[model samples]
Target: MTRYKMEEVLPLLEERVRRYTHNESTSVTYEKARQLMESLLYCLEEGENGNGMDIMAGEGDVKTAFTLGLARKKEKIKLAEELFEKIRKDFHSYHNHGYEETVMKGMPAFFLRYDIEFDGKNHLLTLDYPLFLEIEELTGIDLIYAYLKAARIEQDFLKHFPTLSVEEILRGFNGKYEEAYFNISEIVLYKALGCIMVKRPAGGLFMTEEDIMMLSKQLQERSKEELESKLQDALLSLDKELHLQSEVSEYFMTGLPKIVSNFLYYKKIKKVFLLFPKRKQKMKLQQKFQDGRVMEDEALRILIEKMQACESLEDRLYMVKENVRSLRDLKEILKECFWGDEFIQVFSLLSQEEVMVLKKEMKGRIAFGKGCIYKYLIKI
Candidate 1:
C-alpha cells in the first residue's frame, strides 16, 4: 500500500544516514539502515494519527512526508506530557506500584529525554501497569497515546467514588495488591458487573456465598449473547450516572467483547471472585452522585443522576437529544425515568403537549408490556 517505491526511498534514507553520522566517511552497517528505516516508517505513520496529514495517499513527496512526520512526533510527545499533568492533578490512585511508577516516574522520564527525530520507534518506557484493555500491536508514540486514553477513562470512572472505598475493594481483591500487577479498571468494572449477576446494586459492590450461587445459576440459564448484553447494560447503567461522552462510551463498548469471552468460562468468578466489596470500612459510603442524593430504582436513579449533573436545563436536554440517535435509545431512556422528580428533572424542558404525548405512550407501554425497568414507573 506504500505510494513510494523502494528505489525512491533509498536516496532519502542515505541522506538521513549521512546527516545522522555527521560525516560522509562514517560507516553505515546494513543493520543500522534497517533500524533507521523502521524509524522512518514510524514517523510517516505518525503523519495522520499525530497530525492529520495523509502521507500515504501522495499528499506530498516521501521526503516531505517524512519531514511532516517528524514535526507530528514532536507534537505528540508534547501532548502526552500535557495529558499526564491533567490526569495526575485531581487523580486518585489505588496505591499500587505499577500504576504509580508508570505515571509518575516512567512517563516523566520519557517526556524529558525522548529522541523523537532519530529514534521515533524507541519505546522509552516499559508501561508496566496493565490496562483494562490494550492495543498490543501498536508501538512508539501510537501505543503511548492509546495507553493514556485508557488511563483517562479509568480515572473518570474511579473518581466517582471515594478513594478509601476503592482502596477497600483492592484490598479485598488482594491484601498484597500493591505488590502485584493489577488493572484498576479491571477490578472495579468487573466487580460492578458481578454485582449485577448477583442482583445487587453495582454501586454497593457486595456479594455473599448465596449471591455467588445465584450468579452461577443465572450464568447457566443465560446464552452467550444474553450474558454479553447484560454486561454491556451494567456499563451503560453506570454511564447513566456518569454521563460519559459518546466517544468514551464507545471506548468501553469496543473493549467489552474480548473480556466478555474470557468471563464466559466462569469457573468460580476467575478462581477468587468472592473478594468483593467487603463494605466493612464505613468511613463514607461513596454513592455515585453529584449533590447529596441517591436513588434505589436503577433506571430512574442513573438517568436522573446524569440529568441532575447538567448545569442548566438546556444542557440536560441537549445531552440526551444529541446522543440518542435511535428509537431504541429513546425508549430505553424514557422507560427508565420514574413517575416522580426523577422524570420531572429530565423533562423539565418538555412542553405540556409533549409531556401529554409521552404520558400516553408510557401508559400504553405499562399496559401492554410492563418490563422490569418500568416497575418503578407507576401509572400516571
Candidate 2:
C-alpha cells in the first residue's frame, strides 16, 4: 500500500547491485547487468504501486528477497547455477536412502521461479519482456527462456496424447481405475457415462440400452465391479449436481413472490394470491375456493384489520407505521402512547410533523362521498 517512485528506487537498486557485485566474488560482470537492474527496479516500483508484485514476493522471506534482488539485474547465469545446486541437494537426499533417482532438471526449476513457459524457440523466451519485467526483480535469469522450455515439454506431452480434452481432466480415478493407469481416454469415457447417468430421473435407475452397450464396451477390458463402482460414483455425483440445479431454480421462485406482492401493492392491481399447501387438507381448501377473487383494496383492508387485532406488539407497530401517509404525526402519537423509543428507532427516516398528522388521521374515519380517506388508509 505504500507508494514508491521508480525514479527514487532505481538509484537505490543500482547502489545495491554494485555493493552485491563488490561483496560477492563472481566472474559474471556484463553491460546487461545495469539494464537488468533497471528492469527489476521498474517491476518492483510498478508492482508496489499497482499491487501486482506480492505474488512474486510471496511472504517476503529472506531467500525470496535475495533472489528477487539478484533477478532484477538479469543475472540468469548465476541464478540458474544456484537453482541447479539446490535441486541437486534435494535429489541427493532422496537417493541416499536407496530410492531411484532422476537428475534434478534445470527447466522445472526455472518454471517454478518465474512461472513462465519455454517452447523450442530460444528467441521466443528472450523476447518475453513482460516476464522479464515482472520476474527479473525477484529472479536471477530471464524467465522468458525457461517458460519457453516448459511450453516445449508440455507440447511434447500433448503430442503423445492427441485426443485429450477438458472433460477428461475433471473425472478423477477412484481406487479401482488406479491399477489400469487410467489415461485421458478412460477419463473421457467415464465423464460420458456420468453425463448419461445425470440425464436419467431418480426412479429410472436402470441404465439405458445405449449406455449399457457403451459401458460394456469400455468395461470389456476391465472387471464387473469396476464398472459397477464407476456407475455408483456417477450416481452420487449426479445427486449433488441435480440438487444445485434445483436450489438455483428455487432462488428464482422466491424472487417471483416478492415481485408479485410489490406489483399488486404499488400498481393498485388485483391478482390471485398463490399459496403453498402445507397439507392435503390445505390443497382441498384451495380447490374449494378456486373461483374466489379478492379485490386489492379489500385484501389490504383485511390485512390491516388482522394486524390491528393481533396480540403481537411488533406486528401492530409495523402495520401502523408502514401504512401511515405522514410518519411525523404518527411519531407524536407514539410518544403520547409511551412508544417514543420504538418510534425513533423504527421510523428515523420519517419527519416528526408527518408522524403527528398520520396519528390524527388514524383516529377518525373521514368520509369523502364514495372516496373515503380513512377507508382507503385501512385498505392500504
Candidate 3:
C-alpha cells in the first residue's frame, strides 16, 4: 500500500477493470476499485507474511508485488489441499453438522472456485464453524490456510482416541450440539479436563455442575501462570495416556487459557445448587424423597411437573433457582431427582440435622428408574 501511489497504479487498475469486464467497461465504483486494489495488496501481504519476503521493499510495482503474492497464495492453497487430504483420511464428524458442512462443503468450494487472481480479497465462505481456538484476525486465503493448519493439529489429536469414545463424549457434551457451531476439540478437551479435575477417568462420563465447581475452584486458586501450568499438566497427562505425538502435545497448550476463562465465567454467574441428571428420556417411575408429603401448592406442583420435562442439569438448576422457594421445594424436587454429588452439592445445601432428617425420610424403596439415585442416597 505504501510503495505505489494511486495515481501510479490508476492506469494498471483501469486495465484490470477493462479486462475483467471484457473491455466493455473502463470504470467501477471507487469502493469496488479500492477492494480490487486491496486484492492486489492482499497478495503482496501474503507473500511478505507467509514466505518471509518483502515484495514491496524495493522498486516493485503493484503487478510485481501481486505476482509474488499470487505465487504464495497458490502454494498455500496446495498445502491446504494436502492438509485436507490428511483430514479426510481418518476424520470423524462426531455427527456435528457444522463440522460436516465446513469440511465437506465449505472447504471444497474454497478449493474449487476461489478467485486467487482477480479476487484474492474475496472471503467467499462463511466459516460458521469454529475451531477450539478460532482464527479471527485473518481473512480469505490467510484464514483458510491458518484454519487448515489448526484443523490438522486437531485431527491429529482427536484421532488418537477410539472414535466411539469421541462420539459418546460429543453426544454427552450436548445432545443438540450439532444444530449450530461448536468446537469439537474443545468439547473433548473439556471432558478430559473435567475428569482430570475430579480424579476420575479422563474422557469418560459427562461433567456435572459439581465437576464444574471443582474445576472452577482448582483454576481459581491459581495465579494466571499456575492455571496455565495446571491445564498444561492435565492436557499433557491426556497426551501421555493417549500417546499423542510430541508436537501435538505441545500444541494443546494454546487452548488451556481459553478453557480456564470459560470456567471462571461460570463462577461469575453463581453456579449454586444441583439437579441429578441420570439420562435422557421419559418413563413411568415412582417418586421417592417425598415420604407421602403431597405437594398441595398448586403453582409449586405445576412447576415441579415442568421440572420433570427439563433434560439438563443447567436447565433444571435455573428452573429450581428461579422458581423453587425453599428446602421443601428442594426435597420435593429430589423425589424426582435421579442421582446425587452434583459430588457433594445437594448435601451442601442442608445442615447436619436437616441432612439426617432428610436421609431418614428418603429411606423408602427405590423407584424403578431411580436405581442410581437410590444407590447414591443410601451411601449418604
Candidate 4:
C-alpha cells in the first residue's frame, strides 16, 4: 500500500528479484505483477496527477512511464520464457505434467512452473503462469494482496468529495452535466466477517436504503456470533473453492477490455456518498452509461440476472467436454442451457478444447462431423 517513486520502486524491485533468486519458498503472483504494471501505466498515461489543466504532468512524462511499464512486462515474459526453456533442457524429472505436478512430485523448485501435458498426441502446457517465475523472482505480490493494496490506494481519490446532492448533480450546473453524460465504474471492497466482498459500481450488489436499515436492525437484534455467521455465509461466497474464479467467475470470464475497464476504473467506496460528478475528469468509467444510481442499479440488476441464468462457464466447459457425445449433441445441450452472454463465452472457450479434443479423436479428420459444431457454434 505504500507509494514509492519510480527511482525507489525500481531498486526495490531489483532487490526483491535478487532475493527471490536465492529464496526457495517465495511465490510469484500474476495479479500483483499486473497491478504493478497497471499502476505504472496509469501514472504514465494519466500524467501522475489529477486531470486539472495545471496539475497534470507533461505528455513526455506520461509516455515515459507508460512505455517503461510495458517494456518491463515484455522483458519479464522474455526472461520467464528463457527460464522455462532452461528447465526443459536441464531438468529431466519435470516432464509432461499439468499444473498439479509440482504438488505431486515435490521436486523442481522453480521460481515459476508450468504444467506441460499432451492430450494423447499433441504436447500442451497449461497457460496458467507464463510469467510466474519472473514475477515471483522480481515481485512477491499476489492478486488478493494487490487488490487489497489497490483498494486502499483508490479510496484516496474519493477525498475529492465528502458529499454531493445526487439529484442536483445529475441535473448538472447550468445543464453542463447534460453534455457531460459520463459514467464511472467503481469497486467497493470490504471484509464480511472473514471474507472479502468485491462490489463494482454498475455490475454487482448494492445496498439500498431499506437493505442498509434492515442490516443495521439485524446487527442490533442478533447476537454477535449469529450475525457474524450469517454475514460470513452471505459474503464469503466470493472466496469459495480456493480459486479466484469461484466466487466472481463472471468478472474474470468477462472479456479482456471489460476486465481492464474494471481494474482501471476501480475505486473504493467509503463514507463519502456522491451519486454523480458533474465534471467528467473525476471518474474513470467502464461504459458511457447515464450518470446516476439509475444506471448503476439497472446494470446491477442485469448482472444479477445474467449470473443467475446459467452455470459458471468453466463448469459448463468441463461438463460438455465430458458428457456431450458429438458437436450436434453439444449444440443441443448448450442451446437450451446457457444465457446469451454465457453462451458466447462458453463457446469460445469450448472451441479451443474441441480443437484439442478433435485432433486426438479423429486423427485430424472430419470423421462423423464430431468437431463441425465448433464452426457453427462460434457464429453465435
Q: Pick the candidate with the highest TM-score.
A: 1
Model 1 Cα lDDT, one tens digit per residue, 135-223? 68877876787788788888887765445546667876777777788787777767766775565555545455466656766665667
Tens-digit lDDT track of model 3 for 1-380: 43567776666677667767788876788887887777767775655554445544555666666577779888878888898888878766777888888887888888899887778777688877788777887877878888878888888877754454565456545667667577877767766665665676553334555665666565556665676677677787787666777767766776667766765554455431111111221111112332434446887778777877775554565565355445566666766752454412344333445556656765674541254544444433
lDDT of candidate 4 over 1-380, digit per residue (tens):
22335674564444343444455534447654444444443333333333332323333333444445344444444454454444434232111132224222321332234211101111122223121111221122122122222222222222211112221233322244334322211222221111122221211122333333344444445444564454444333533422333324333232223322322232222211232222111231212212212324454445435444655554454454444444434344544455433443344333344545433543434532353433434332
Please identify model 3 stretches exceeding 4 Å from their true place: 48-59, 200-226, 270-380
Q: List the residue pairs that clash in candidate 3.
A: none
lDDT of 1: 0.63
The Cα local distance difference test for each model comes to 0.63, 0.35, 0.63, 0.33
Give RMSD (Å) of candidate 1 vs. truth: 13.6
Assess candidate 1 and give its TM-score to the true structure.
0.67
Q: Write down the worst ten-residue block by lDDT for model 1.
A: 283-292
Given candidate 1, what's the lDDT at residue 3? 55
List the pairs of residues colliding in candidate 4: none
- Quote each prediction's TM-score: 0.67, 0.22, 0.65, 0.20
Reference-based TM-score, model 3: 0.65
